[model samples]
Each structure stands twice: as structure tokens, then as C-alpha cells.
Target chain A: MSSILKKFLMALTGLALVGFLIAHLGGNLYLFLGRDHFDGYAKKLEEMGPLLILAEIVLAGLFLTHLFMALKLTGENQTARGAQGYADNSKNQSTPASRWMWITGLFVMMFLVVHIKMFKFGEREKPITAKGEEIIKAFNGEEAAKQFARESGEHGSLYGLVQKEFKRPAVVGFYVVLMLVLGAHLSHGIASAFQSLGVLRPGWLQCLKPWCVALAWLIALGFALLPVCTFFGIGIN
Target chain B: MNFTLNVWRQKNANDQGRFETYQAKNISPEASFLEMLDVVNNELEAEGKEPIAFDHDCREGICGACGMMISGRAHGPRAATTTCQLYMRNFQDGETLTLEPWRAKAFPLVRDLVVDRSAFDRIIQAGGFISVNTGNAADANALPVPKDNAELAMDAAACIGCGACVAACKNASAMLFVSAKVSHLALLPQGDAERVRRTLNMVKTMDEAGFGNCSNTGACEAECPKSISISNIARLNREYARAKLLS
Candidate 1:
């Protein structure tokens, strides 16, 4: 594919992923409503069965394609300079986030692997079905500590799993840092996607860069806060 | 002022070049950087040695012919100043400076400190012109161009195609140059007819010429003689993506 087309595909796939994050965040937010709401949300997602699997497959394709194209394009860009390189590279005018995109992207990609393993598609899912489900149910039943805790019964209790996982300081720290890296990647990527698709205007340039970066920060904050709040027992019974 | 000059010396395009150091003594502080080179070249000529062959025309900044790497930075250390506009006063009396050509795969080395920039001309040839023929000058206010757009077009049109953007880029990307040309025309009504074709063809030419993809490093903008905005690059991407989607 042409470089331009590759970039367009990246933008399309990236924006779609961002849309998925929004929905995922919304569903995750139901955790604050207690165990029944949280597990029910997960059940609804799994209940889609083939449709959910199809969506996951599409999501994986979009994600891998984005990574693949980004790597290829970055490699080509590096080769274009051949052996010639600037002696005073520090003089470049791009932002720090813009400059370190590949590094941050790589980090984010690594985090994504760990993330899917830990939460989405890793060994966490295996024990979830094999034995951990009952343990989670027991934890959810001990909600007598808080008066505001919803009376929830007969669910997988993902709320317990989340609460248990976040209580670990190391896990929460890793998540918070990962969210920041994800923020940096999204900050450049969002406005850049618009420019890649030819939708950005000069008038929008000033507004777009900061707003996009800010939006990335907001999303990061939203994600980052979850572990912090979980550690503080916001939704834990 | 007296200084040591480390000039890139390549006999021909195929010849491997290395820095040939020479002493430039008794140089005027106010002399342009090119003039200091001229003095050194005259001294070389007096001794029957080959004067350093570099590209320059219209010693002022506007012509776009004069360009070289002065101490690793394109044009010169001063931001928004062309090599021709750079003065010896900017350097210290005992300063040692290195001069090299704008290095890119697309820009083939012709000799010392001069690379064939006709690749740029070819890129311009691809779609830099409007096909529309305006018969004659109509009224003073004939074709209406919005004021802000007119100014922005002129801002983009200010690019002299000096290849500083190419020089500054770590990837050797020409997105800024291509975008400047595309945008200058795209923002105008006369440019409307060829907008799609122009962006597509120019980008194709740029890519085929072995230029790198833009990383939006803004190095080009930092070193540009005209200070062309990277936003133009964003516009170029925008235009290129639109063209690809349509045709």
C-alpha cells in the first residue's frame, strides 16, 4: 500500500479502537454500581457469543494492522536517511510526545500484550473459569462492611477480582504508568489521525493539538483513576 | 576575522568526500558566509587550486540557490536565515565551522557542497501548476480570494524550495515542501480543478524520489528559511488522503 493509504488505514483503525475504549470504559464504569452491575455488564458482552467473538477478531485485526503499519513506516523512514544523520538533532522543533512516538508506541504495545493477558485474554481468564469464580462470589457476598453496597447475588463478581487485583501496589503503579504512556501515544495520534485523513483545518490546528492531547489526558485520567479508586475501595464491598 | 573551514570535498558524484580543512584569514566580520567562501576560493584560484564548487545564485535569501550545512544545522545557526543571509559576524574569530551539502537520497551529489536538486523541480513539474487559463486581467477585484486565505497562501508560497526542510529532516522527508505547493494552489479557486490530481501526483513523485515519510518532527520548520509551518504538512497529508480516497 502507498504511504498515504497506510496512514489512512492507521487512522481509521486507531479511531475505531478509541471508540471501543470509550464503550469499554462505560461498561467498566458500572463497577461503581456494585457487583451485579459489573458482572452483568461482562455477561452481556460475553452473551453476544459469535458476534462478540467476531468483534474481538476485528478489533485484533485493527490493532495488529495499526502496529504493523506503524513499524513498517517507521523502518522505511529510518532507511530513507541511509547512513546520513544530523549531528545536531537536538534542534528539531517537534514536541517531546511527537518525537518519542515510536518508543511510547512500542512501550504501549508491550503494555497491551501484558494488559490483554492480565485483564482481557490472558491466564486470568483460565483460572476465572476453572476455580477463581467461586472465590470472587464469596468476596462479593461479604459486602456487609458498607451500607451503600448494592445487594447483589448469584454473579461472577468481577468486582471482587478487580478489587483484589488493584489492592496490590505494584499492579496499580504499573497500570498508572501504562495509562500515562497510552496518554502520550493517544495525544499525538488523535490530532495526527485527523491530519492523516485530511480533515484538519488551519483554524483547527491550535485548538486540535491541545484538545487532542487534553482528551488523551482525560481518557488517561479516567483509566488511571480506576485503580486508584479501586485501591481506595470506591466500588469494593 | 580568521577561522578554520572544514569543507566537504568530493571530486564528483561517485567520489567519496571528506572534510578538507583550510585557513580563512583576514575575513570581514560583515561578509556573508558565501563571501567568506568566495575569498577562500579566490585564494585557491590564485594558487591554481580548484575553488570549492558550491551552489549559489542571487546572493540574497530569495533565490533559493544558496544552501549548505554550516555546523550541522541547515542554512545556519540562526533560525529562519538562509545560508546566503548568514554573516561571518555571527561566528567567533577563532571559530571552526563545517560546511556540507544538503544530504538526502533524492538529492544526488554533483560535486562538493552541491547536490542536484532537480528532483525538487521534477516534483514541482508533477503538479505544481494550475492548468486553468485566465484569459485576461479582469477588474482590479476580479476573482475573489478570502483575505485570510490569500495571506496564508502567500505564507506558504514564500517557500523558496531551498531543501532546508529536507536537510533538517532526520527522515529526509519533503512533506513541508510538497504541502506548501499544494496548499498555495489548493486554497485558491484556480487550483480547484487539479486539486485531486495535483496532491496525488506530487506525493507519488515525492515517494518515488526516495524521500522519507514525515514524522512531523518540526525540524523542517525550525530550520526552514521561510519558516513554513508543519501545519502545511498536515494539510498535505489531508490532501493526499482525500485524493487517495476519491481516486
Candidate 2:
């Protein structure tokens, strides 16, 4: 395929992922409303059953397509630059974020793997309610966990898992750092995606540039907030 | 002003290039960058050595022939100025300058500080012109071109095909150069006849020439001697998409 078409696919998938990030951050922010509200939201998503699986499939498709195009283009670009580079080449106008997009993108992908493993396939203990803990202390094994969840009138405790994970300083620190990397990636990616799609005019880009950066940080900080707040005992009680 | 020059000296495409330092002694600050190089070349020739080889033409910055990486900047440190137009006064008296040719897979080195930029000519030949019958120029104002379009076309047409955009880009992408050519013609009525074919053919030729894809870093615009806006790139993208959809 042509280079333009490759870039066009990259832009479309990237924008779609940005949309997913916005929605994911919105849903995750329910954690601030305390355990019930947050767990209830998780339960609602779980209740979607096959539809949720289908959504996950589509989201995965978008992410993989974006990743594929990024790798393909980066390799081609490197080859096109030739083997003998300039001895003292310096950047005139390209930003650090723009130049190091492939690095940041790769970091984000690694973070996603660890993130999904930690949250989606992580431990699902009994809810941390007083009665639930009492039941857990009173009994043992998976039956007691299910009994406690049923008695507490709650689904599996995603909120409890989130609190457990964020309480770790290492986990919180990892999340905060990766969130910043994500912000850096989006800083260039958002505006670049629009430019690639040819939807944004040059005049509009002057104003849109800052907004794109702001939106990038906004989403990153929003996702980072949950871990930091949970670690500081803000939403834990 | 005396300056230290560390210039890339490549005998040919197969030669492994290396930097050789030469002292430019007692040069006038009023001379253009090319003139300073000429002085150094003259000194070398006087010393029974082959003078440094570079490219130049009109020497007025309009021909797009003279260009080099001066101290890591395409066309030196001046914005919107070509090397031929960049005066020596911009640098410190004792400053050390490094000069290198435009390095890209599509641009092979021919000699010291001179690379073959005929890839650009090939791209132009692909579709950078309008196809009209052989005749006298059309009467002025015969085909009504909007004022905004005419001005924008003129702005895009200001591109001199200097290859500075390629020199400056991290990917060495020529999107800016190709876009300027594509936009200049695509924006006019005469170019309207082959607009679709022109955009497709030019972009295809650019890709086939081993130019990297543009990542919208804006480096090309920053270093462009003509101050060609990346808006032309955006227009090129739009034109390509429109043509693709229609075709």
C-alpha cells in the first residue's frame, strides 16, 4: 500500500484509541464516588456479557491496527533516512515528543499489557465491606468469597482489586510515570492524527495545537488521578 | 572575520565521507555564505589542492540551487533564508561551522557538499505541470481565479525546490516539497483539468523515490527557505484523498 494510506490508517486507529481513552477515563473516574458506585459501574459493564466481549474485540482491533501501522512506518522512515546520517544534525522545529513518538508508543503498549493483566485478570477477592470481611474471616476458599459477595449484594469486587493494587507504592509510581509517557505520546499523536487525516486547516491548527496538548494531559492526568488518589487514601474510605 | 570550517568531504557516492577542517582566514563579514565558501575554495586551490565542491546558480536565493547544512541547520541558522542569501555576519568571528550535504536515500552524495537532487526533478516530471495545448498564454482574467486562491497558489508557488525541507526533516521526508508543487498547481484553474491525476502521480512518484512519510513535525516549514507553509501539505493530503475517493 501507499505511504499516505498507511498514515491514514494510523491516524484513524489512533483517533479511535483516543476516544477509547476518554471513555475509559470517564468510567474509571467513578472510583472517586466510593466503592459501591465504582463497583456498580464495573458490574454494569460485566453485565453487558457478549456485547462487552464484542466491544473489547473491536477495541483490540483498533489498537493492533494502530500498532501495526506505527511499526511499519517507523521502519520505512528509518530506511529512507539512509545509513550515513549527519555528523551534527540538530532539530530545528520538531518537538521531543514528535521525534520520539515510536519510543513513547512502544512504552504505552508495554504499559497496556501490564495494565490489562493487573486489572482484568488480576485477583478478585471478597468485597472489603465489614460484613464481607467477617464472612471471609469466618470461612475459607472460593465458596465463602461467593457467599460474601452474594450477601453483600454486589458483583465481584473490581473496586476492591483497584484499591488493593493502588495501595502499593511501586504500582502507583509505575502508573504515574506511564501516565506521563502516555501524555507525551498523545501530545504529538492527537494533533498529528488530525493533520494526517487532512481534516484540520492550517489556520485552525494555530489554535488547535494547544488544545490538543491540553487534552492529552487532561486524559493522562485523569487516568493517573485514580491511582494517586487511591494510594493517598482519598477514595479508599 | 576568521572562522573554522569543518566540512564533509566525500569524493563520490561510494566513498566513506569524513570531515576535514579548514581555516577561513580574514574573510569579510558582508559576504554571503556561498561567497565565504568560495573564498575558502580559492585558498585551497591556491595551495595546490582541489577546492571544495558545492552547488550554486542564480546566487540570489530564487534558483534553489545553493544549499548545505551549516552548523546543523539547513541553509544556516537563518529562518526563511537560503545559504546563498545568508550573510557571514550572522555567525561569530571565531565560530566553528560544520557543513554537510542533504543526506537522504533519495539524495546521493556527488562530491564534497553536493548531493544529486534530481529526485525532485523526477517528481516534478511525474505531474507537477498542467496539460494545455501549445499556444500563446491565456489572456489575463479570462478564467476567473478567486483572489484568495491566486494568492495561496502564489504562496505555494514560491517554493524553489531547494531540498532544504528534506535536509531538515528527521525522516528526511519530502512531503513539504511535493505538497508545494501539488498545491501550487492544484489551486489554479489551469491545473484543475489534471488535478486528480496530478496529485496521485506526484505522490506515487515521491513514494517510489524512497522519501519517508511525513509525520507532521513541522521541521520542513521551519527550515524552508521559501517559508512554504505545511498548509500545502494539508492541502496535498486533502487533494490526494479526494482524488482517491473519486477515482
Candidate 3:
């Protein structure tokens, strides 16, 4: 794809990921409302049928597009530098934002895999239970639930599995650390995506920085707290 | 005050390098980073040991000639400053300092901390100039460029050809440098004629030279002595697209 198209894809996918985060956090925050509440909410999502399937497909596409564009841009950047190292003379021309991007991006990607496995895949592997009871998840209908269950297991307790998994202190700690890294990555990435897309002006960029930072910290902390709270038995109040 | 220095040492470009620790005694807070290095070099010279060989041209901030990684940071602890302009006062006297050459696929070591950065010169040669011949253009003000465009172009032009961007960059990409040069000239009417050729050729040259792609990191701007804006890279992207599509 063209450079500009690649950049646009980068931004678009980034925005999609951000949207997913917001939704994911919203569902997760239900954890604070008590187990049955979260279980009920998850059950409703399960009932969404084709709509939920569509969203997952779209979400997967967005992730793939973003990753592909990032890899392409990185490859082009490597081509620009060629075989020689930049002279000391060019040192003054580099920026930490541009320099640390790939490293942070790689870390973020790794974190994403772990995150998806911990939550999405892990949810599939286990079943959802509220205070140790089978939650009636909506997710389309019994047929769709059966489909997911057949795919996952004879009877899927995704939510219960989520709770059990988060109950481990070590796992919770790892999740918290990864969340911090995600926050750092987004702290630069969000603003950077805007800059790359030409939508950010200097003055506005300055003004938006604190808010962006606040948002990143909130999401990271919010996700991180879920596992920690689960481990500590501090479920909602 | 005294400080511990971990400096990369190599006999030559072909030699394997190692870190050598040295002590700097009675260092002054007011000394520039290069000046501090000068003291160390002087001591080595006095001791009949070969002094560390590094590159430096204008000690002033204007020359993009001097740069080295300090404590894993391009141009030391300061932001938006060059090594020649970085003052020792910014550093703690007793702290240990790690110094090394800029590491990139394109820039290879010539000696201890000097790398051959001529790849940059090659990229520039590919298309860093306008094709206007024999001063055949209209009067200087005749083009009547927008004031904002002119200012932005100049801001991009402030890039001193220093490779701090490359060193600070994890991939060691030269997009910032290539983009700045392209944006600066492409914004002006005098450079309009060769704009398409310039972008395509320069980008091709940059790619052929082994530089990494731009990943939208701001590290280059942070370490830039001239404080060249990363916004220029975005502009170059637009220009490159236009060149590729329109031409």
C-alpha cells in the first residue's frame, strides 16, 4: 500500500483499538457492580448473535491492519537509513518519539497477545459464574451459545474462568505491569497517530496532551485494577 | 568534582570494541560535554596513550558535526540540544557516564566512537536540491509563498544533518532527516519544478542506503540540536504522496 494509505490505516486501526478498549473497559467495569451484574451483562453480549460475530470479525481485521501497517512503515524507515550508521552529525535530528516507537510497539504487541489470551481466549476456555453459579449468558440464543460452547467446550464457563485466572497474584501482577507498558505506549502512540494523520496542531497537541495522558492512565489502571481487585477479593465495594 | 566514564574503545573500524572506564577528576560544572571529553583526551595525550578519536567541527550549536550517545540517550541528558552545546552543569559530578557512537546499520565505526555517516551525504546527493539551473528563476519575492509555509519550511530546514535522530531511533531510521530536507525545499516555489523527482529519488536513495522507516516516534525531535519539528515529517509524507500520485 502507499505510504499515506499505510499511515491512514495505522490511524484508523489505532482508533478502532481505542474504541475496543473503551467497550472492553465498560464491560469489565461491570465487575465492580458485583459478580451477577457482570455475568448478566456478559450473558447479554453472548445473545447479540450475528452482531457480536460481526464485531469480532471487524475487530480482528482492525488488529491485523494496524499490525501490518506498522510493519510496513518500519520496513520503509529501515530502507531510508541504508547500510551506514547516522553520523554523529545527525544525532540532533532524531526524536525519542520516533526512536522508541518500534520497541514500544513490539512490547505492546506482545502484551496484546497475552491480554487476548488472558481475557478473550481464556474466557472461551473457562465458563462464567457469579459467586460460583452458572450465569445465563444471552449471546444470540441457546443455539449460538451452544455453538460457542461446542467450539469452546461442552459447556463454557468463560466468566468463571476469567475470575479464577485473575485470582492469581502472579498473574495479576503481570497484568498490571503489562497495563503500565500499554499506557506508556499509548501515551506516545495516541498523540503520535494524530500527528501522523495531520490532524494535530502544535497548540492543540499541547492542550490535548494532559487529557490524553489522563485517559491512558485511566484505561491502564482500570484494566489493571480488575485483576488486582479479583485477586484481593475486593469485588465491588 | 569527579565522574566515572564508560567509553567505547576500539583500535579501528575492524577491531572489536569494549567499554573502558576512566575517572574524570576536578571536573567543572560549567564545562560543555565536549570540553569534558577534551579534558579526558588531554590526559590521555599527556600519559602517552592514544587519545580518544571522535568527530567535532563547530563547537557552537549551529554545526551538526558533534554527537554521541550518553547514558543511552542521544546528546546526553538534555533535550533539544547537541552534544557540543550540552553543558556539564546538567550532569551530577559523581555520576557515571556511558558514551558510545551512534549505532545504525548505515553508520559503521571508523574508530572508537566515530562512524562513517557518509550515507547521509549520499541520500542528500540523490535529491536534496532543486533542479533550477543558472539562476533562471524569477525574483526572490515573486513567488509570494504563504508566511506560514515559509516559516514551517525554514523550521524543517533547521535540521543540521546530525544523526541524533538515527541514534535516538531504535530502528535508526533516517526518515526525519530525509523528510525535513524534502519538506523544506518542496514548500518553496523555487523548488517546485523538481519536487516530484526530488521526493521519489531521495526516498529511493534513502531506502537503498539501509535507513529504517519512520514509526512516528518523537525521539528525533527531542534530541535535535536545531529542534527541527517532527511535523515536517508529516508534511513530507503528504508531499511524497502527491509526488507519487500526481506526477
Candidate 4:
């Protein structure tokens, strides 16, 4: 693709990913509402099997589009030669936004692979417990009464798996870090996507960078807080 | 005062280069960095040795003729200043200063501290001008540009075709240089006749020439003697968008 077209694809894919994050965060926040509500939400999503597949396909397409554009541009940037000397326009223009694109994009891609393996493909099916005794053993410190306190009536569902995962501090911490990286990536990616697409105008664009970064943090934090809160037995009921 | 210099020396573009150290004694603190180099060069010349070759035309910084990486910085420690404008006072006595030509694939080393940056010229040639034939232009008053646009154009036009933007960039991308040209010409009515075509062709040439993509880090602006804003990059994006869509 042409550089401009590639840039546009990057912008569009980035925007799509941001949109997905907002929706995903919203769904994940149902955990705060109550266990029954959250489990039902998960069940509904799982039931939309074909639709979820379609969403996944769309996401994959976007990722491929964004990745290809970056690769093409990176290649093109490698060959040109130019006249020597200090041009007035070039001094001290480097920014973090420009330098870390490939690094962060690659990091995010790596994270996404693991993220999909763990969350999307693995967890989508019925809760795959090694054994009931293993769950009980993992929760060994707590008696059966305490372990069953939240699950009470519902144990073999998505909510039970979530409660189990959150009970592990390591799992909660892992997600918190992941969310932070996601937030940082989204922060830079959002406004830049607009600029790439030609929708962003000067004068008005300044306000968008901070706002986008903040919104990204908020979304990531929203997803992260529940895992942490639930693990600590603070917000989970 | 005494200082140590780790200067990169190469006979030509194909020659293997390495850092050669030279210790200076009784150096004046008032001398500019280039002047300090001159003292060293004069000593080398006296000793019947080849003087270190670097590019420098106007010692007054406007020429954009001198840019070297000093201790990992494009133009030394000073912010928004070129090497020509740098003075020796910023350095402490006995400090070691490492100088090298801008290290990027696009910039081929021609000799010690001098790299061929002709890639920038190719990008300009691709489409960095307003095509107006001599003695055929309309009255300047015929075009009433917004005050802000005119000022911004002048700001972009301030670029002196220096490769400092390429040097300062981590990717060695020349987007800042190319964008300034695209934005400056596109800003005026006389240039509007080919704005879309100009932006597209120049940027296409820039990419074809192997300049890395712009990450918008603003390091180029910080190192620029002219203090050119990264805003010109945004304008370039706008121009590219229009050119892509309308043309």
C-alpha cells in the first residue's frame, strides 16, 4: 500500500482497537455490579458465538493492517540519502511518541498473543478446572465455607472462574501491569490515529492528546481495579 | 585548561573509521567548540598530518553547514542550538568530548565527521517548491493569507536545508525537513495550484529515499537552532491528507 493509505489503515485500526477497549472495559465493569449480573453478561457474550467470531475476525484484520503499514514504512525509511548540514527545521524535534511506536507496537503484539491465548481461546469454553480438589487445594488456606462464600450457589460458571483467578494475587498483579501498558499505548495511538486519518485539525488537536491518554488510563484502570479489588476481598460480594 | 577529544576519523566513504583521541592543553575557555577543533587542526597541520575533516562554512550558525553528534547529542549539550553556535564554555576542563558523524543509513560518511546527506536534496527535488515561472507571477497583494498562516509559513521556511533533523532523529527520518518544505509552499496562494500534488510527490520521494517514518518526538525542534516547531509536522500531515483525498 502507499504510505498515505498505510497510515490511514493504521489510524483506522488503532481507532477500532480503542473502541473495542472501551466496550470490553464496560463489560468487565459488570463485576462491580454484582456476581449474578456479571456472570449473566459473560454468558450472553459467550452465547453470541458467531458474532464474537466476527468481532475477532475484524480485530485480526485491523491488527494485520496496522502491522503491515508500519513494516512498509520502516522499510522505505531505510534507503534514502540526503545532502549534508544542519537544517533549521530538524533540530531537537524528537518526541517519545515517534520513537516508541515500533517498540510499543511490537510489545503490544506480543502481549496480545498471550492475552488471546489466555483470555479469548482458553477461557471461552466451559470453565476447565483441573479438578474440584485442585480448586479446593489452591484455596487451601480458606475452609470450604470461606471458599464457597461468594460462589454460594453458582460454582461451575464464568464468575466462579473469575473469582478463582482474582483470588490469586499474582494473576491480579499480572493484569494490572498489562492494563498499564495498554493504557500507555492507547494514549499515544488515539490522537495520532486521528492525525493519520486527516480528521484531526490543528489548534483543536492539542486538547486531544492529554484527553486521550487520560481516557486510556481510565479504561485500563477500570479493567484492572476489579481484578485487584476482588483479589483483596474488598469489592467482591 | 586541558580537554580530551574522541574524534572519528575516516579517509573517505569507504574507509574504515574509528575514534582517535587527542588531548588538548592550554585551551581557552572563551573559544567556540569549532575554534577548539581549529586549534587541534592547526597543530595537526604543523605536524605534517592530515587535519580532521568536518563540514563547516558559516561559523555563525545560520549556514547549517556543521552538525556532529557530540556525546550522543546532535549538536552538543545546549538545547535548541546548533554546533556552530556552541561554545567551549559549556564543557569542563579535561572533559572528554566524543564526536561522530550522524549515524544513519541515509547519511554515508564521506570523511571524518562529514557524512553525505544528499538524500535530503532528493526529497526536496521530489517536490519541495512552488512552481512559478520567472516574471509571470501575480501581485503579492492578490493573495490575502491569514496572518497566522503567513507567519507559520515563514516559520517553516526558516529551515536552512540542514540535515540536523535527520541527525537528531533516532530513526534518522527526514520527515521534519520534508514536512517543513511541504507546509511552507502549501501555505501560500501561489503554491496552491500544486499543493496537493506537491505534498504527495515530496512525501513519496521522501519515503522512496529511505527516510524513517516520523515518530513525532520533537527532538528535532529541541536541537534546531531556528527553534522550528514540530507543528510543521502536523501541517504536513494535513497537506498529505488533502493531497491523498482530493488528488
Expressed as tens digits, the lDDT of each residue in A1-237 for candidate 2 is 888888899999999999999999999988888878988899899999999999999999999999998999999999888998888866567898999999999999999999999999997645556666666666764675755555574445888788789999999999999999999999999999888888777697787989999999999999988899999987654
**Lowest lDDT 10-residue stretch of candidate 1 chain A:** A122-131
- The per-candidate TM-score of the B chain, in the order shown, comes to 0.98, 0.98, 0.95, 0.93
Q: Retained native contacts per candidate, as fractions? A: 0.56, 0.70, 0.38, 0.34
What tens-digit string does per-residue lDDT give for candidate 2 at B1-247?
Answer: 9999999998999998899999998989999999999999999999999899999999999999999998888998989999999999999999999998998999989999999999999999999997776368778887799999998999999999999999888888999999999989988888888999988998999999999999999999999999999988878888989999988
* Clashing pairs in model 1, backbone N/Cα/C closer than 3 A: A198-B238
Poorly placed runs, candidate 3 (over 4 Å):
A1-9, A26-54, A65-181, A221-237, B1-6, B21-48, B71-73, B78-80, B86-97, B133-140
Could you give the C-alpha RMSD of every candidate to the true structure, in order shown?
A: 4.5, 3.3, 7.2, 5.5
TM-score of 1: 0.85
State the C-alpha lDDT per candidate: 0.83, 0.90, 0.76, 0.74
lDDT of each residue in A106-179, candidate 1, tens digit only: 99889888777767642221113323445456668453422123322323445666776888999999999999
The parts of candidate 4 lying over 4 Å away from their true place are A71-98, A123-156, A198-206, B134-142
Q: Which candidate should be chosen as best, given TM-score against the real structure?
A: 2
| Regions of model 2 farther than 4 Å from truth | A128-155
Chain B TM, cand. 2: 0.98
Best model per lDDT? 2
TM-score for the first chain in candidate 3 comes to 0.78
Candidate with the larger lDDT of 2 and 4: 2
Once all C-alphas are superposed, what RMSD does model 2 give against the true structure? 3.3
Give the per-residue Cα lDDT of candidate 1 at B236.
84
